[model samples]
Target: MKIDVEHVTKIYKDTKALDDVSFTLSEPKIYGLLGRNGAGKTTFMEILSGHILASDGEVLIDGENPFDNQRLTESICLIKEGDNFKKDLKIKNVLRIYAYFYPTWDQELADELIREYNLNPNAKVKALSKGMASALGIIVGLASKAPITIFDEPYIGLDAAARKTFYDILLEEYQAEQRTIIFSTHLIDEVSLMFEEVLILQDGKLVMQQQADALRDNAYAVSGATKDVETFIEDKEVIQSKQLAGMMTAYVYGNMEQAKSAGLTAEGIPIQELMIYLTENKGA
Candidate 1:
């Protein structure tokens, strides 16, 4: 499924949720939607999911608008943060309801996941804990088998072990059925490995959209004697740097295939650290 967002902008009474944001998702792969708090991530997700409209520009899912369109919306499953299920509905009934709406829903997978996540089918939706609720939402999302599945911080209440289980299950599901997955979360270091592409938003604008591998390939940290480190990074775009006494460390982005500076220690920058630097030093 190809989802094209063109010059999208959203404005509130005095706040601009998004400012001329644009991107194209032409393939079925995992994309990490990253940014700091209130970086227009949720706003953009709402627009793409058809829960809200862009004040300007358009979002096209398979060359068609998804706003209130059952055909397009059915192909997309958005598992929002926190619990939003009916208190009266049992866990089993909730899955049944989801099955009714999602045409590609898999009952077998749902049942299996419910057991795997230790969620009781007879328990009421409101009776479950926050972590259980998140687990149920995750189960629904993975079981939906929608062409486009979005999980907007769906693991807020989950612990490290449970989160790991979710990630493993999600990767397995995606491998079985290659579908577009847009995942947004602040736990970048933990899940960055699952992303094929990373999109960073800042203050209502899309700051960067790059492949995960490309970002790592281009980003590196060099440390050595101040003179050597500076000389080695002189021709590169340094995102962040620091020095103490005679030692200097520079975070750079560029081709370093032939960079053979003696006494310099070069290391690949982690995605999470790079993201923090990018957001902290905007427009640098």
Candidate 2:
């Protein structure tokens, strides 16, 4: 499904959660929705999933609105960070309920995941540990087989090993059947490799949206003598720079080859670092 966000905006009292953000997700690829705290990542996901209405503009999935639209809602599954189910519901009941909501729900897969995660279906949501609850959410998200699967910080309280297990299963599921997956997480370094495209929000604004590989290929950290580095980056788009002890390193969005040819030591910037540089308060 093609997701089209056209000038979408959201407001909460005096704060603008989203400010005229526009982007087109035209392919079924894994997208990393990245931003720091309160950067409107959650707000954007809510608007996209129809949990909340946009204050202005619109979000269209295959040319139709998602809000209160049953057909689209069935095709969209959003697994949030926490509190995904009612406290009174048992694990089995939660799965059963979601199975009814999502026509494409796979009971077999859900069962397998529950066992794999070592979750007891008889346990109530209130009794499960934070990690266990997150595991339940992951199972629902993967088994839903929704055309658009949005996971917002879905693995809270999970240990590194458990998180890896979820990531492995997620990749396997995506490979088995391609669908749009929008993953929002704070552990950027851990999941950055899975992102085909990255969209970054900064202070309620769309700061960067680009192909992950292209971003890695073009963005570089060039280091050399302060004067030489300064001269080389003068005409380039510098995301950030630091000078120390006569040496300067400029995080630049430009040709790596050109930087290398200019006698500067250039290295590709990791997506996580790139995001930090792009979103940091440069004026400071």
lDDT of 1: 0.89
RMSD of 1: 1.5
Best by lDDT: 2
Of candidate 2, the 10-residue stretch with the lowest lDDT total is 275-284
Using TM-score as the measure, which candidate wins?
Answer: 2
Per-candidate clashes, comma-separated: 0, 0
Superposition-based RMSD of candidate 2 using all C-alpha atoms, in angstroms: 1.0
What's the CA error at residue 250 for candidate 2, in Å?
0.3
Can you write out model 1's per-residue Cα lDDT over 156-211, one digit (the tens) per residue?
78999999999999999999889999999989889999999999998888878999
lDDT of each: 0.89, 0.94
| Model 2 local distance difference test score | 0.94
